[model samples]
Target: MSTAAEIADHKSSVRERVWTELRKVAVADSRFHFDFGEFIADFEGGEEAVHRLIDHSFYRDAELIFITPDNCLDRLRLRALQDGKVVLMTTYSIKRGFWLLDPAKIAPDHYLYASTLDGMERVGQHLTLAEIQATLPNVDYMVTGTGAINHEGVRFGKGHGFFDSEWGMLYQIGRISVATPCAAVVHDCQVLVEKLTPDVYDTVVDIIFTPTRTIEVHNPHKPTCGIIWDRLDQHMFDTIPPLQELKAMGL
Candidate 1:
């Protein structure tokens, strides 16, 4: 096994390499298939499979759903609409991290909805854009609990830091308190044992959901080091206007 510092260095390099691969693959796939959607639909029950993945967390009782940024599978979350089982899922927000997409339009008055940073809004029990905007640092709605979480060690899309940036901003602003449970769903093929060098700003998830099973992490939160004002990157701070305002207010 490599030392902690060495593992971090290796993992950082792996992250970069993986991002390059995903970009190239995504681009090539897009070019050859102008109607990739139609092509995917041709597969026996491919559409249904997509729906299954998106609704997985909801079926597991996830109140908040966090979807990936890839446009290819955007419509998968619409299948979870069962009356009384409303769930909210986040999409790319014009401002930052993610915004909730309506869980009902696809199913009718079947689900509830909410919004986030950007102009991103959706159907179902809508939380006024203003309310999400006013989320305070110490609010209970923003808090999460600590526990063993898993990422399955799968790298996200090209690792542009959007996910990390969004989580970090929420954490800094006190939106997602220290206790909120977070996890990533992935195929078992995505798990990695490599060392991860998490910076002070990195927000780790509490669990990893695989197609077959769920892996629990024991302790998820990291120790707090001093804040690095200069270290705040564009992706992290720019998406959150409130974060900027808070900083100006003396962050």
Candidate 2:
């Protein structure tokens, strides 16, 4: 077995490679740009990536989906909306709120507009974290975009750590269980060959659907108890409404 340091080194090297790949994609494509250290403005091949998700059981069978608001995955959300799937979107990285799109509440023909970031306001209802929890069923699947990932299922977001926090909160509240399937969609180059180590609270994707491939990560390490509060800075509690609420509850 490789040492932790070795695993980390491999990840660091691969991260750099992936970053270069994304940087190139951003430059060559009309749709993308580098956002801070991560590319988030847009990507040229997003529509193609969305089709990979659509081809999977995770997307085809899920009635309720938890999705990130990354523009790269906007079409995934749009497709979900068009199929009449209920989508639960984190409010700008899960700091502010949660938005729910119940197909019954939206007009079918206008799905694309409702899927956009701005349209989410008109198409979905804003709810407090608690309100969202109360009405939600076990999320059938979760779709996210990652800065880097490995075939072993280890992955990292854009350093904000919001996606794991959201998953942790849901597990803490009993909405997402061990069996819940999570998928990450990215460009083909984002899939790294070396194993990436995860923090105790970092949730790994069960499957990775890239524009060019589908990889099943038989992840062996699973963090059952969610959220490592100490991993968060105090500013998180102050600025993130749901974290503030969680802190107040003394949980």
Per-candidate TM equals 0.55, 0.87
Q: How high is the CA lDDT of each candidate model?
A: 0.41, 0.75
| Cα-based RMSD of candidate 2 | 3.1
True-structure lDDT of candidate 2: 0.75
Show where candidate 2 strays beyond 4 Å: 1-14, 27-32, 36-42
lDDT tens digits by residue: candidate 1, 1-251: 56867755565566455433333323223333423221111122334434444444434554444443334333333433332223333344324323444444434542322222122343333332234446412322211111111253233323344455445544554455556665544434334555454555555655655445556566765324223557656664666564465466563
Question: For candidate 1, what is the lDDT?
Answer: 0.41
Output the worst ten-in-a-row residue range by lDDT, candidate 1: 140-149
Clashes of 1: 15
lDDT: which candidate is best?
Answer: 2
Clashes (candidate 2): 0
